[model samples]
Target: MGKSYYYVEVESLAGETICLQLPNDLQGAMRAYRQAHPITWENLL
Candidate 1:
């Protein structure tokens, strides 16, 4: 099987959902998430 990844919902600055799942690591999922969805999203849900 493929490597397991974390799941979550990404929210945008306009209060809209951009996508689901960030797939970050213990070091910094938020960091990964931020890098992945830069300029489009503002928060995670």
Candidate 2:
């Protein structure tokens, strides 16, 4: 297999703070992360 590079950046102020290091397909990683950790009212704090 060959190595590939991908870059993804979203303005932090747009939503919650994410400190994840996603090296895979950004869309897929984000989808999985959101599915695993859905935001709730308590998260706002």
Candidate 3:
């Protein structure tokens, strides 16, 4: 088994951070964040 980390979701500038249990799959979270945030391919490099 792997260890668990924490995930924080910030909706607004003044919004409180929503904490959740982060599974070992970081790729999923990155993908989800990329879709939600305005991230470019170049920035990921």
User: TM-scores of all models?
Assistant: 0.32, 0.34, 0.31
Better of 1 and 2 by TM-score: 2
C-alpha RMSD of each candidate structure in angstroms:
9.9, 10.0, 8.1
Q: Per-residue lDDT of 1-45 in model 1, one digit per residue for the tens?
A: 645455656688999986566534442755566679987545554
Report, for every candidate in turn, its global Cα lDDT versus the true structure: 0.60, 0.50, 0.56
TM-score winner between 2 and 3, please give it.
2
Candidate 1 Cα misplacement greater than 4 A, ranges: 1-27
Q: Write the per-residue lDDT of candidate 2 for residues 4-39, one digit (tens) a residue.
A: 333344448778655545556564655555557777
Instruction: Find the 10 residues in a row with the least total lDDT in model 3.
Output: 1-10
- Alpha-carbon error at 10 in model 2, in Å? 6.3
Q: How do the candidates rank by TM-score, highest first?
A: 2, 1, 3
Off by over 4 Å in 3: 1-24, 40-45
Model 2 lDDT, residue 11, Cα:
47
Candidate 2 colliding pairs:
none
Q: What is the C-alpha lDDT profile of model 3 across 1-45, one tens digit per residue? A: 553344555466787676565565875766556667755732652
